[model samples]
Target: MKNKMTSHYAAKLLTASLLLLANYAFASDIVFICHKGNALNAKEIRTAYTAYFDEPKIVDNKALRPKLLQYLNMSEHQYKKMWEKQYFRRALTPPVVKKDDREVVDYVESHDAGVGYVAEVPHGADVEVCGK
Candidate 1:
């Protein structure tokens, strides 16, 4: 009876692990989008979000903010506090927050200095996917 219970718990744990892994695998669909002429690699994208880039106007989708913050290795509250500190120091402007992926894409397409992230890179959006 003990062996059977242990096996059952192990199987359940394995299933849960697999599900978490699957979510992470699919999360790679996020692509960083920027204006057609602007290009940024992953490192540059990270720097841009952290307020190191002055030329590009950063935008973020509210729906994806938490995931993007996770990608940046910070929680949402931590990110906000960091940006607030940056603003207080007069170092950089906080990123413009948008409603969703569509709005982010639209803002990026319309502004030459715009940069944002979306779940998928849309076809002919007049923006380039700089990083994933």
Candidate 2:
């Protein structure tokens, strides 16, 4: 009985460790995607996400925001605060928040200048990856 209990505990620990590692890998592997018609590059993607771009329709994936913030080395509070400042100063609204990658891909497919980041591109999403 003791050995069985120990084995179960060990398995649980290993599974938890794997889950953490998977989340870290996913968070670090964000891909910036845009409409096929746009030519936005990596630098522009970074600037558009961290700074400002008034042209492209920006879509923020809520499911990927934690990973995005981790990649940007920003706390959730800081991210929201920065956007608040942008709104206050330049009246630049933050990106439209979507529930997941599917919504973002759909938006980009429909909008010519749409841009967004996603954890995984949907299988049939008619979008192009512009940045890593």
Candidate 3:
């Protein structure tokens, strides 16, 4: 009986571990986004969202912006004010899509120039992960 109980607990532990791993695997991923027409870059992404720089250099046509607007119930201006306290002065372009993070991921995956925030661990080849 003791062995059986131990085995059951081990199996349950394994199952829990697998579920945790799967949760991580399927979590939403955020990415920086911009108009396909914009000539932004990754450094811009760090600057725009993080508010840690005056002028972040662009690399490879990407832009960095925050992904929490909808959740915060705020407009771009409010977001800017919060960031400006930290020193980001650049004008922010509107998000390419109006939908949520999942939608952003779908759009970013399909559009070559579409960049946005995502929570999923990027697989490369499809969307680029900015700001680590």
Instruction: Write one digit per residue (lDDT tens) for candidate 1, span 1-132.
Output: 999999999999999999888767655547899898787888889988987777788998888886787678787788999889888886688999998888999999999988999888767688988964
Clashes of each: 0, 0, 17
Instruction: Note the Cα lDDT for every prediction shown.
Output: 0.85, 0.84, 0.49
Q: Candidate 1: which pairs clash? A: none
lDDT of 2 by residue, 1-132 (tens): 999999999999999999999978866788889999795987787677775877777889998898888777788999889888987887877889999888999999999989988887889889998864
- Give the runs in model 1 whose Cα sits over 4 Å from its true position: none
Q: After superposition, how far is residue 35 of candidate 2 from its true place, in Å?
A: 0.9
Which parts of model 2 have CA positions greater than 4 angstroms off?
Answer: 1-24
Q: Give TM-scores for every candidate, taking all chains together and pairing residue i with residue i.
A: 0.84, 0.75, 0.36
Q: Compute the lDDT of residue 37 as modeled in candidate 1.
A: 77
Q: Model 2 shows how many backbone clashes?
A: 0
Model 3: weakest 10-residue lDDT segment is: 56-65
- Is 2 or 3 the stronger prediction by TM-score? 2
The most accurate candidate by TM-score is 1
Query: Model 2, residue 77: displacement in angstroms?
Result: 1.0
